[model samples]
Target: MDSQMNAPWSNCSIGYSCVKLFPPPMHTVPHSGEAQHRTSPGVEGRGRMKRGVQHRSNGRSARKTRPGSESGFEVAHDFGPAAESARHFDPARRGYTWGMIRFTLLSFLLAALLLAALTGCSRMRFVVDLVPADDGLTETVVHEDDDARWRSPKVALIDVTGLIADVRRPGLLTRGVNPVAEYVESLRRAEDDSRVKAIIVRINSPGGTVTASDVVYRETVRFRERSGKPVVVLMGDVAASGGYYLACAADRIVAHPTTVTGSIGVIMQTFNFSEGMRRIGIHADAIVSGEKKAAGSPFEPMEPEHRALLQNMVNEFYDNFITTVTTNRTGLSDEQINTITDGRVVTGRQAHELGLIDEVGDLYTAFDTAKELAGLPAARLVKYHRALQHVGSAYAESPTGSSSTQLNLMQLNLDGAAMHDQPNFFYLWDPTIFSAVR
Candidate 1:
C-alpha cells in the first residue's frame, strides 16, 4: 500500500468517527435559592460534556461537571462550560468591618471616662470641708500627766470675732464657713463640764445683722441662768452695735483702753440706680400686686412714704436696743443712757466714764474678772480657735498667734447686697461699710 493510503487514519478523526457503548447521565449543579443548567448540542451519536459551578451568598463556590449524554460516540468539539467569572476578593472589606466595631467600642469607653472626670471635678469645685476649732474640744487638755490631780478650775474663752453672722451649711456651688455655730457649740460644751467654772466671750467685731446678735445674746443669757456660771465679755479692737448687744448679756464687760465701742443703732439702706439707668438709656418695668410690694426696688427712687415706713420699723429696734442697754447697766440713768445712745463711737475710757462698760482693762484683767466672778483663785485659760481657712505665707504672722481674725468688709457687704438683691436691717457700726467698695 502507498504510505498515505495504507495509514487509513491511525487515530479517530472528524470524518472517521468512534463511539463508546455507554455515556454517563447528565446532572444539574445545585445552588442556594436558585438553579442554573448548562448544555451543549452535539452531532448524532456523539456525547457532549457541560461544566457548571454552584455559588453561595458568602462568596464561596463548588465546581461540578454535567455527565455526557447516553450516546455511543464522544464529541471532540466540546469544551468545559466557561468557569463562573472569577470573583476578586478584597481584604479592605474585612478590615472595614473590624474597624467599625473597634471604633464604636472606643467611643463608648472614652465617653464613660469623660463623664466620670466631669462628675468628680464638678463635685470638688464647691466642696467646703469644715474642720472645727480645736477639732471639737480635742485640742484642749485640762492638765499635764503627773499634775492632772492638781488641775485648777477651767475658764473657757469663746471668741466672737470677725462678723457675727449666721451659719449656713455648704451648698453644691457655694462654700460658706461659719464661726457662730461653732462658738455656740463651744458654749454648750462649757455649760455641761463641771470643771469649767466660767466662760468669757471675747468680741472683736464692728457688728452684724440684728437677728444674729440677738441669737448670741439669748444663748448667753440662757447659759448664765441654766448653769449659774458667770459669763464675762472682753471687748477687743472693735466691738460695737451687735457686739455690744451680746456684751449686755454678760455678768460684766471689760474693754481695752482704746477699744472702739458703742455704735448703738439700727440701719437699713440700699442703692437707687435711677439716675445711672437714665444715663445708660435703660428703663425697668415690674409687675406688682400692690403699691408697697416693690418697696426697695433699686430701679426707682425711694418715696418719702416708703422711707417713713422703714424708719418706723428701725425706731422699734432702736427702742429695744436702748431698753437692753439700760437694763444690763443697772446704775445708768435715763439721762446718761440718752447721752451716749446716739450712734457715737467711743473709746474704752469714755465708755467707762459713761458707765457703758464695767471696767477699762486688758485681756488679762478680763480673765481675772471672770475668775473672780466664778470664785476661782486660779484657773486654766483656754480659748476656742479654728485653723485659718486660708493662711498667709510662712514669713507672715501666724493666724493662730493673733487675737482675732479681721473681716473683709468689702466682701461681706458685697455678699449682703447680693443676698436678696434688697436692703436688710443691720446693727452695724457703719452703714457705708455696706456701700460699694469701689
Candidate 2:
C-alpha cells in the first residue's frame, strides 16, 4: 500500500524525491560547483538523517490513517451542525439570512470598496528628474500644487552632454530640467537628504567655464563632506577640460573605454575677432571705467595691457583647478599629471595609463564604482529619469536646462576677479578649430 504522507517533505529519500519530482529550476543547484556530501533520511527509519541518505519509516514516524479502511468505503460526517444550520437552503431560497445576509453582503462590499480605494492610494515613488532649467518654470503644477519644491526628494544624474560654455546650442528636447541653477539646488537638496546614499555625476561634456565646473565640483565636495555620501563621476563620451575638473571632486572616477577625458587643464579663449570683424567690416567700440575693464573683449585687437592681464587671470584659475585635482586624486606622480595636463584630451585607456581615471568601462562599471565609493553591498541600479507626463510639464521642479546662463558667465570667468602676476593657462582649443568654420 502507498502510505499516506504527513510531513511537508517526507516521501522516501531525496534521491527518490528527485526521481519522483525534481525541485524547480530556480531551486536546483548547478552541477559545475563544488560537490556537497548528503544522505537520505528514508533509509534511516525516519530518524534525523542527512539529505540524500536513505532511511526507512518506523514508529517514530507513525502517520495517522483515514478511517473505514477495511471495506474501502469512504466515511461521511454529519456536517449539518444542527437543525439551525439546515436553514442554509431556506435562507438561500429567501435570498438572504434576514438582516444578517444583508449585513454580511454590505460588509463584503465595503471591504471590496476599501481594497479598491487602497489600490489607488498606494504611493509610487516617481523620482522627479529636475535640474536647473526645465518644466519647473511653468505656472501649472502637477503631482502636487502649492508646493514649489518637488513632492519627493530628488537625486540628480548630471549628464553633461556637450561642450559646457557660456554659449551653447539650446537642447531641442529633454526628459528633465537642465539649468545649472537647478543643479545647484539639487545639490543643496541631496546634501540635506539623508536618504540619498550616493550621487552619480554622469559627465559627457568637453568642459566649460572654470567657475561653473568649480561650482559643481565644490558643491559635490561639500555634499560628500557634509553628508558623508559619496559622489561618483561617470565619464561618458567626452569628459575633458572643465568636465574632468568637476569629476576630480568625486570619490571615484569611472570612464567608458572610448570616453575622451583628462583635459585636466584650464583655458581662456577670446576670438581676438578683431581680424574677423575687420574682414566683416563691423567695427565695435567699448568704454570702460578702468583700463583693464574690457580685458578680453573680442571686438577690439587685444591690447598688450589687457592681454597680459587676461592671461594672468586664466593662469590663476588654472592653478586653482589643478590644485583641486591634485588634492582629489592621490598617488599619481606630478610628472604623469603634467603629461596629461598639457591641455590634451586622452581616451579612457590613456587616462588609466596616466592615472587620470580609476577604471575603463561603461555605465554598469560606473554604477559599480559608485557602489564601491558608497560602501554598499549592492545598490539597486535604477535610472532617475524625469517624467514630463503633463502637457506643459508641471512635473519639472526647475526648467533651467543643462547649461548656465550668459548672465552668470562673469561668476565663472572672473573667479571673484582674483589674478596673479604670472599665470599659465590650460588650453583645449582644437588645433584645427579653424577647419570647422571652413
Candidate 1, residues 277-361, lDDT tens digits: the string is 9999999988999887777788899888877888898999999899889888998887888888899989999999999899999
lDDT of 2 at 21: 48
Error at 23, model 1, angstroms = 78
**Cα TM-score per model:** 0.61, 0.52
List ranges where model 2 is wrong by over 4 Å. 1-158, 163-178, 273-290, 389-438
Q: Give the per-residue lDDT of model 2 (tens digit) for 239-311.
A: 8887888788887888888988776666555556788788879888897898888877767877898878887
| Best model number under lDDT | 1
Q: How many clashing residue pairs, candidate 1?
A: 2
After superposing candidate 1 on the true structure, give the runs of residues whose Cα lies further than 4 Å from its correct spot: 1-135, 139-150, 168-176, 386-422, 431-438
Query: For candidate 1, which ten residues in a row score worst on lDDT?
Result: 1-10
Candidate 2 displacement at residue 146 in angstroms: 39
The local distance difference test score of each candidate is 0.65, 0.54
How far out, in Å, is residue 403 in model 2?
Answer: 10
Displacement of the residue 119 alpha carbon in candidate 1, Å: 28
